[model samples]
Target: MITISGLTKVYESRGRQVTALDGVDLHVREGEVFGVIGQSGAGKSSLIRCVNLLERPTSGTVVVDGVDLTALAGKGRRAGKDLRRARSSIGMVFQHFNLLSSRTVQDNIELPLEILGVSGAERSRRALELLDLVGLADKAKAYPGQLSGGQKQRVGIARALAGEPKVLLSDEATSALDPETTRSILQLLRDLNRQLGLTVLLITHEMDVVKTICDSAALMEKGRVVETGTVGELLATPGSRLATELFPVGGAATGPDRTVIDVTFHGETATQPVISQLSRTYNIDISILGAAMDTVGGRQIGRMRIELPGRYEENVVPVGFLREQGLQIEIVEPQDEARGAAEGEQAEARDARQDESQIDKQDAAPAATAPALVKDGAR
Candidate 1:
């Protein structure tokens, strides 16, 4: 429900201009979790902040559900009544939780309602419902200092939903948690997406987060979006950098005679025994160098690097056979010299075949030269 066009963000630090976002264009559909991934300085943080107008764009439009937030706030850093009213429908969860030290979990969740002039009874009731929604019902009275990192994030999520926003912007929301906790938080987000039909736009440096929860993803580099698509689409795309980053297959050294190929398996193909079928059909030994396989969005997706017995020229048919089975194959190396020599040999064989054809034609014709040689013997 969020559409961003030509969005740019620039800041000045120490008299030097820093561009955090550059002509970014993004669309996040309603009721889906979209992820933005990048390294430290790729400006993913700036992109998400601009979605909710937490950071004003240098130019361009930020439209959510047909409302242009950039126009509502005017061209300034301050938040006017119109902007704040618009922001109340958009929830933001920070990496640091951003909870008040003196506030209990319930109080923290109720803070937004309090500022919105909600009645005390209604605020308490909504806070309790949200705490239960985030599975933090028992921690309602617990202070932020008494909660664990994951628990604190749960409080943050609950507080963000306190306004019953149609959109949720998560800025590295699970970056501070442990692996197990991260999975739990991700599952929580997934559940929330299904239950509340909340549209999530999350930015993270972790590939696992995208793999585990995101339905669609964008890869950012140096303030530019280099790649974006559904997880399966990205995996099926040839030479997709995001696919490689998401499913990393290690490289192994191979002898000159061996051919290495990377095969991508998606959907039902991931469960197929295509590798074994190739070995049986070609009677050639196959070695797996590395494999990265996982289930994304309840579907199997994987990449496997394998080595075949002979060079690519000898195994072209076998690779084609694998491709016929709906597997995406990429040759990691090409034996150029060997292929050239083979082509030369084929050319020589073609010349020899032409000479043999001429001799056969001469033999089939009347043998005049044999008759001349036999005359002396007959006399």
Candidate 2:
């Protein structure tokens, strides 16, 4: 388990001060895949860097398993043996697989155990075991240049595990991979977390990666934690502007005669018939313009764009009904003003119809008098 409290980091450049982390507090339980997400300059990098003492925090503390790493600062040379021992229990995989190109896969993995002064026979055995764990047993003799992006990452993971660390820090581990490869690597990380009971801290800008492996996540913005919650809770509400990055639906509205709504389906609502039933019960015409659905922790989360053929006010009934059914609904506003102007045109057309009806009645009166006059003349 890892705990970060009041973590703050500031940098000075060209007479300007930039805060990388601002009093950030995070608690990651043992065996949990915790994701830290944010855009560029969100202090995600700074926060995690402070975890293993990679970047010393300007304030606050980084505690791992009851040991405050910040307190151990500057003991690197004097308390050399202790520093090595503490770091041995924490494994790190970087964004760029920093493997020694000159060393073979086996040597790269064995490098950590070698540093830990593990026995020769034990290092060889552990390196092979790690290679198997990462599904690269066949590439044990290959060099970094010989492997693909995913393989090099696997090698990085295996090398990190050589010390048999209880905590694994992944720094954009899959960002460089293709979508498919990213998925595979994330799955592998999840499997490793469960299999090894490893506490993982994964830092990335990709919310999809967090949803895949993290049970809980914290959204960082401008070096501040804007949102933090279980994946389920975040998906259910997604209230924080930072949270909506995971589920985004953008579209232009047609007219005020129609209401455009962005609906997110998660958990039970994903499997429910809320959308269709709401439309049918209201007897409102519903048109779907766009949709996206994907699996997170084996649960399906979908976003649908619906256009209701009626006034926006009229669709409020159905929207309330949907929320009652446990759907997160947000009304989508059109970029164009025509979406609201259509109602005015409808009113004008109604007035025109009424005017036509009145003209018919007046014309009937004239025709009736004309018929009588004609009869009188004939008589």
lDDT of 2 by residue, 1-379 (tens): 8999999999998999988889999999888899999888888888887898878788998889888877877634344455557777899999999999999999999997887788999999999999999999899888999999999999999998888899999998998999999999999999999999999999999978976888889988888998887777776663445445666554555565778877888887898888779767988778886787878777888888788887778667788998888888777666433443575578889999999997786577765587776686599
Q: Estimate each model's TM-score.
A: 0.85, 0.80
For 186-205, candidate 1 gives per-residue lDDT tens digits of 99999999999999999999
RMSD of each: 22.8, 18.9
Q: Please, what is the whole-model Cα lDDT of each candidate in the order they appear? A: 0.90, 0.83
TM-score of 1: 0.85
lDDT of 1 at 37: 98
Off by over 4 Å in 1: 334-379
User: Which pairs clash in the backbone of model 1?
Assistant: none
Cα-based lDDT at residue 341, candidate 1: 52
List ranges where model 2 is wrong by over 4 Å.
Answer: 14-16, 74-83, 257-259, 309-317, 332-379
> Which structure among the candidates has the greatest lDDT?
1
Error of 1 at 45 (Å): 1.2
